[model samples]
Target: MQFKPVVALVGRPNVGKSTLFNRLTRSRNALVADYSGLTRDRHYGEGRVGTYPFLVIDTGGFEPVVKSGILKEMARQTEQAIAESDVVIFLVDARAGVNAHDHEIATMLRRAGPKIILAVNKAEGMNKVQATAEFHELGLGEPVPISSAHGDGVADLIENALASLVNPVVESSEETSMTEMDEEALEQALATEEGEEVSQELFTDHRIKLAIVGRPNVGKSTLINTLIGEQRVIAFDMPGTTRDAIEIEFEQGDKKYTIIDTAGLRKRGKVFESIEKFSVIKTLQAIEACNVVVLVLDAQSEISEQDAHIAGFILESGRALVVAINKWDGLDQDKRDWIIREFERKMRFLSFAKIHYISALKGQGVKALLKSVNEAHAAAFRKLATPKLTRELRAAVEQQPPPRKGIFRPKMRYAHQGGQNPPLVIIHGNALDAINDSYKRYLESRFRKVFKLEGTPMRIEFKSSTNPYKDSEK
Candidate 1:
């Protein structure tokens, strides 16, 4: 496997590092905002500039002097991204001019330098050339004036960055590791257990793709860090520390998994920033792309409408779901009891989703949460034979037949499994269009109960069976 040259986008917060990142990758994966330090982790994305394919790492704002708290951790992550990268696009805000923090970051990058490409972002038109004059004091090189927002001079910056990596490159060791891991992954095929044998097909053929999602500040990033046993993402006290959908691949006990950490979503009224609006769309896209979605909720408070909205979207997308209540290590028994009662009253619709109370900070109850994630993935991909599906549909209709609509009684003639991954089933019948939402819900419930699809979504499609003789008659 050939390794793409890794390029690190380093700068202070809100300096258009993420904006430049989005421009380069052609993806709004990173969250962008006017607020400082919105991005607290190193987000990785793949991009190409004029056929030059490369990897890009968007690091959080680089505050060089912070010695304590989350800023220190952010500094550490940014430095690590720089160290691993072959080239660094040192982004600066032309609008802000040469600030103290920018100078500090410049000094740090100069000392621990890679091939640095100085980019003066937000500099457009005639001001572009003059906007880079102040950055000359940083002593990196001639600043590449570019507008990340409008794609002005961005391609030139990328071209220069890739040009620096053309010659004198070392062979990567990632290919060797991949070869060894692939061999090991294949060796576990059809391995025998203590008594019963577990098929390695679960590990080889399909790896669980899980997404961690919830409202802002609900420990979604923390839970992913705990599960992966690494601080791969920046988890901070800030309400929206994570701004992008970060995907990390790893293996546990011979089983492969790709976990996605998405931006926390707030209600539309509260969401004011254009950047956050983009983040919301990315989170929704992530939910649709994943096999399972872990809906993390704050255990300290009752479930809110934001949680319900997020859940409704997940169920509507027909993705597997796991409800994880975080911050469960502390609190009195009464609060726990209240949470249960609140769920029973407000969230009974999610009875199909397995719920776990966990402390993401301390990694409590996380293993069981992952077990549920795996089970839910399997349930979502379950395939039912034609005969079995027809029988189950007949049983479901017998229990609660669709009520007569005025003069006509909707009939469920037969059913068959149309697809898997949220098991889509097609129900053929006469007057199926008359069946209302209530009947659809009833059939969905029956499908879950009969097929044992406990923690995943199931979809039902109604179709009016066509008559073959109609073409000749017409």
Candidate 2:
């Protein structure tokens, strides 16, 4: 893997660090709102200037003098980000001028080793003299005036940031040469194989992107730390410790996977906090982006409506799912059975997903859980042959034919795969519009059973054949 220089965005609460992050990364991945401390965790994103790629770390607000509580934790996270960064873009509010918190943060950054660039944000209309006047007192260096929201002076800011890096980005020609060498090596290997096909597997990104999601304090971050075997993400003992969807890439056995540690999702009615609302949106997006989702459920607590809602969203999105009953080590056999029963009663609709009892803290049943995840990923992308699909459709119809709807029975003819990743089987027939949801579900079950499509939700689509003669007569 090539090294991408890390750029850490550091500043006080509501100083436009996230806006600058979004500007540099060209993504709204970091939640942006008109509030102090909307971002709590360090969110990493990839940014590029021309052909040079660099990693941007969007950190929480820096309160260096904070002693206790979440602010202190956020300060620690920001400090860690600074330590890991190649360049630190210490952002300041041009509109707000230099405050006590800004001085405190600047004092801390001056002692740090990274290349610090003091940026005066929200300076779109201000001249260089006005923008630099207030910030010069901090004494980091010349202030780069920028408007993070309006994209003013951001390009120059990034260019200047990258230029200060120790290992400068390699030229495009050198990068191209390296890519050409890789392609040449691949071609030589394919030539040596002699009649064997190796094109599809070689060109594609085979990493399984798995999203681990659940309610607040359900060991989602704990599970991620256990899987990665490191404390890459802060697994603090708090309800909302994780507020960003942190993606960590790791390998298990021979398989490569990118596990997303998403923020806990609370019920919409209960989420009054603006930051939590943004966290909820980020969690949903993580589910949509990943190949499979590991829905972590609290083994001790009763299955709530919120859990079902999250599960329902996953099903609606048609993503492959695996239910992980977390913190199983703490629960006795009887309690475990009770929790399982409750889960079954509440989330019976998610019968297709594989369930596992695991202690994310102790690493119990983790291997089995990942195995199910791999199986689910495979099932989601599994190809269905048209002839086989048609045959299965005929067999299903023979076993249980559709009931008549006002003298018109559904005449199901054949089926073919319309799409994959929550595989869609489109059935062509007459009076197909009469086929109800129940019959459609029955067909889905049959196809699933025949194809062994476990850990994935399958859809059965009905396409009614139109009569050309009826149109002509009309």
Candidate 3:
């Protein structure tokens, strides 16, 4: 399989590597921070510079002589990044000039020897040339002057990096993902006669894009790893270990899945560093991209404000939802009862979603979670014929008729399914705005029950199709 050429950004702390990464990818996949050593892991994203398309890996800021703690781990990770990359962009702060840390990294890069492109960042406008002139002394050749934050001279840096790629690998995210054929289907396909075109309609990727989201250290990554049945993501005890939204695909039966593992979200006041702020941005974006979201909560802890905030976000996004309570293995009956009660009190707005108690560490109760996810996704795609929808509407009205607004008894004309994925039902009437909340909710519940839309949200829109001929007659 052809893999895209990898370009890595290597430099000392606080030198705009993540900013450069975001700019290159045209996405905020990598968290950018003003403080040093905020990035801890390798974040890979696809980007193009003019004619060159490549995979960019953003590593934690390289600290030369660190021996232990998170910094040491970061240094080790950066080294691994260099070894894997085809081209390395050594970003240095032009304002600060080249320091001992820069020399240390440059020496290592020279010995390792990838296509070294020196990027002198924070150099913009008329002073760009003068600021970059000193970097030539590092013996790496000309330093491409640019401002990562302002998009200055970034194109030249990309062009220099592109010169090294001989046969560029053009691969999509799906191709890179781990996709397996369903066992029974795979066996059937292999048994087909040679050159006889076996129909591939069975292998079609009707995969649901499910995103797992929650607060820090809530086992988001662990839950994802369990769901995919692989250690596809780094699950650590440390908070903020996952810095980007990572996508991994796998197949079960005929259902393909692209599961998105997002960085943990924390409340704004607690988010001090710039990196943490960026991580929150990445999480929100992941929710927007997904078809269904699994909001993981720590069963051991009480439901905090952040939990409610995250749940509210999913409801607002209009995505199908499954609330998975993680770390359920050790919880006692009392704790479980409390957890269930907490969800009930907080998530009344999202009563449509099904909740699953799961132990991701032990792989318990996950199969049921998958089942709920499937049902929810299928419901989102549900389409109702107009005649059937109208009948259902009439039935609903007869059961609980619309309330009179002063003198006028609103006439219900027609009903139709406008869209799916939180199935949208449009009911045309004279004064839909006057439809009381209780009646509206009653209809929503009735429709969900009739359509069997469990573990998925449903929306009912009251559209007023006023009769124009009534006023003309008067």
Candidate 4:
């Protein structure tokens, strides 16, 4: 799986960690409450700052004097979060000032040695800002004052925290060396790997892998039919009709693509049949294998839990996601707008995905959908030249300087394009772990806007000066 950077919010009870998490993630996935210890389990959500996306983890709050089993479990979960996180947000309540519990948490965070950002929550008005000075006594550096409820300073706090974790010198090139093989040779190799009789003629020179995924009966099959202009895959109103993934080859604008139609996925307990069990696993495997995923959603149905589950899988797998709202023929403009807005709001984690409204049965937006697919495919393989990347890096740094964690100012030495096919770029820098998410997002957004990687998911590999070995060398 692709490794997205992970940030964990750690603090004592009732310090608005969950509130901040919801704000950063732009989702209500985490349960927020006034009561302490309500969040007993760890919650994971996708967080985005500009175009740079990362996983945001919300752990149960810490309580120093508690000895109950539940509190002990919460502590264990917090410790695990610290260990797994790439950066830690040491949140404190500015309204409450620096208390004994805040001091204790700061000590533990220092011991953990992860990149730390002290966030002072509930600092809203001028008086609260003055009170925020008290948090300086915690000794975790100048606190970023924020109000989780009113959405003030949270963005700046997150931007500052994440900016410290990015490495600007990473190379931006496809690590996979292009093997100059003829169509016959490439097909033969792939067939041999699969241990099956596959057609060499089916493989094309510039083939793109696109997987159709969604809840059952979202017209995935219908959309595929519209794309290929053939009823290659069966389309029916019956749910779970597609029991296995079927790959079809087609050419679009001189480029070839393998379109995969997968079985409709349901919740685990709802999926009982053996065929369905196998189909779910196969669909997940296809998602991992494909370069881009077209998530089909029913325009008529409200965005269901199953849709979110499928989207989550695609995002977590680190594949480029495109949303196709099928069966948009009868809907009015207002309805379409409402659906689009609500869908975007609910699946905010999939904000990276481009949305298309289509009437698969009527062929209304099929052409535009295909064009988007082509653009997304091309974007997926985009690579940046070293000079251009370095220029952009310099510009980004000059615009907004990296956050200083101590006396040392982290310097990004160099960057190079390492690979494509989901473009990978690596940077060499000082204290690479301290490069925060905001700066990383700024750099990524700048890179995407300049390079015009409109619909692809690109990864930035942050490497310190000590680790210079490329995968090719290994």
Candidate 5:
């Protein structure tokens, strides 16, 4: 399959690379801030310039690292992104003018073998423009003066950049003729599994879409890497290492799964100060799309309010969940038990989910995790027969009668499993919303018990239905 072009953004610290990223992509996908080193890893987002679709990579701003450490790691990631890009948007702070570090980064970019576009950012007014003149000394080309914050001179830069691409654009009629041809090509590509011939469609028929979610630095990327047995997603020691929701598809023991590594969720109050707010939105989107969610938790840290909030989203979304206590290698037995018990008690709504202790760094417990995932996926799609469902409904009704408000007795007529894959059960009833929380919990408990659906989330929709003729006669 043909892939889109990649554009990498590189600049000195606090030079507005992130800001320029947000402007170019027309998305706040990258974290932007006033401080230096806010972005510590390479964040990828899709961008379209005119009709040219390209992948925009927002790299951490360069910090002149004299020695090997996290800063060196950050620089390496930036260099890697620049190396892979089709075009590099080399940003320079118009306000700061040309500095020693700017020169250093420009020298590196010149050797990277990508088409480099010089963007002099923070050029808000005349003084900024006058200051941008010093950037000519870097010797790449003419600096495209732009104010990423104010959205100035961006469109012209993109238009110019796309015009320089190597590919020739086909005419509209030619493109339309190629549509049927492309479908046949795509079908052929899908028939082969990465160069191996497959008789049946491995992933096309049945696939598990799972999202790995947790707070920052909870080893979400590491878990994905372990599951896929490769470095599909970049992992680092720093918090918020992952800034984009990256989807990768792979098969394990013949079961195909699509794993999405999401950005960590921070407290909404704290997010105002942190630049990773965009990442949080991406995580929420991932949660909404996935069939099952694997909530990764740092085994060392106490369960915080942010963790609970993230769990609440999964519960409300009504997706099958698996709580992965990551970093289990370092934890003592006592600590491990305490954390498991606490997580269970605090996240009572998610108590049905199975908890597994795993060390994504060491590749421990990943096999069992995958097995549980397969089971949960099957349970999510498990269909109950009408007779069986009615029996369970009777048991539930007998255990706890619907709430009585003074004189009236609430009645539930019938219930049926309407669908599978997050297994929705529709209950036809009278004054459904009036059913108390306690009775709702009882019904949920009874459903779980009858089905033995240990780690799957079940939905009970209360549909208040009555005879249409009776209402019309009234």
Candidate 6:
């Protein structure tokens, strides 16, 4: 697999690093405010300039002198980002001038040994030479004056940054050229009935991006370390130990997986610190980026509303889910029964997901958890034949036709596969706009049963047709 070059944006507090991040990636994923230290985690985003695509890392304030508390952790994350990046964009505030902290960061970057691009931000209306004059003392290189917020000289900055890549951006053709036989097979697939064999060549193996997420200190890091057979991430006993979203690539048997260990999420009301609030945002972004989610829950404690909230967000995101109740070992039968009942009562909506009890500390049920992850991934991307889908839809309507709303009963129609990753079934017919929620759920259940779409969310969209002649007659 070809990997994009990573560009790390390093700077002190309130130096417009996040602003430059949003400007480069063309996304506001990194929360930007006037306050300092708003970004405490390494937030990742993808940016493409025409055919050139690369990954960008937005880091927290780089106070290299701060040796204690969250500042030190943020400094560590910036260093890691710097190490992984092919080029580093050291941002300095043009208004603030070259400060002691900037000099300190520059000294460290000199020894770090990545292609460094010194960018002078907030230089919108100032003279380019006068704006970049004092930054020469940092000794990194000639400073590139640009305003992150005003979009001045930003594209040139990115082009220069990507030019330093060891492996230049070679655009891969996305168009899949199919042979005549493959085309015929695809045509037959649309007409094939349920349980019939389709072309094996239609499917191909690729890496699965899985994310392990949950509340703070719920053994998420422990589970990741146990899965990779190493203490890769910090698995400390303290809460909020893992602050950044760390991606690790490893293979189990023949399957390749890139597992992301993300920061813990706290309820909004309980999140008092601004850093934790930003951590929550990064966690949510991680959930959005992955193909499957492994929600790690604490088996020792009662199921909290926060856990359900996280699972609900997963469902709303339409990603495949696998629930892992961690620390299942050493629990009494009574406690286990109580936990099961609590889960059933609270997480009844997540019945489509596969659940497992595992002890990450003891390596018990780990294999089964991975098996469920694989199964969920496959189900999420599974293809459904249109003829089979339509047949199943007809059978569902026959068993229990939709009830009449006033004088118009919703006419039944054929269904076809519209998308994957949360298989979308589009039903085309008249009066579909009047279908009730209960009937929609019923159809969903029927489709889920016939298609065996377990461990993944399924969606049904109704597209109503209009009668052209009725308008003229009226």
Taking the candidates one at a time, how many backbone clashes does each contain? 0, 0, 1, 33, 0, 0
Give one digit per residue, the lDDT tens place, for model 4 in 193-262.
3422321122235678888877667787777777777424332332332223456677665677777656
lDDT of 1 by residue, 50-152 (tens): 5566667788888889998888877876776676567889988888889899888888877875788898888886475688888899888899888988989
Alpha-carbon local distance difference test for all models: 0.72, 0.75, 0.72, 0.68, 0.69, 0.76
Which residue pairs in model 6 clash with each other?
Answer: none
What tens digits encode model 6's per-residue C-alpha lDDT throughout 205-295?
6788888887777898788878888323332322342223456777777667787656543332223343452344445556767889999
- lDDT rank, highest first? 6, 2, 3, 1, 5, 4
List, residue by residue over 1-474, the lDDT tens digit for candidate 3: 123466889999899998999899887544322233534666766565656766677888888788888898688667766765678999999999989999999998998867899999998764867998889889998888889999988877787678666454455443233233344743453454432232112223567888888877678878877876642433233234222335667767777787765554443222344344334334555666688889988998887766776676677668899989889998789989998999889778778888899998998998888888888887776665555565678888897788899997766756656666667787776788888888888888887887777777778877676567888995
Off by over 4 Å in 5: 1-205, 230-245, 263-278, 431-434, 467-474
TM-score, cand. 6 vs. native: 0.58
Q: Give the 10-residue window scoring lowest on summed lDDT in candidate 2.
A: 174-183
| Model number with the top lDDT | 6
**Cα lDDT of model 4 overall?**
0.68
* Candidate 2, residue 173: how far the Cα is off, in Å: 35
Return the clash pairs for model 3, or none: 380-421
lDDT of 2 by residue, 86-110 (tens): 6899999988999999999888887
Please report the TM-score between candidate 3 and the true structure.
0.54
In terms of lDDT, model 5 sits at: 0.69
- Model 5, C-alpha of 374: deviation from truth (Å): 1.1
The TM-score of predicted model 1 comes to 0.52
Assess candidate 1 and give its lDDT.
0.72
Model 1 stretches astray by more than 4 angstroms: 1-204, 230-245, 263-278, 467-474
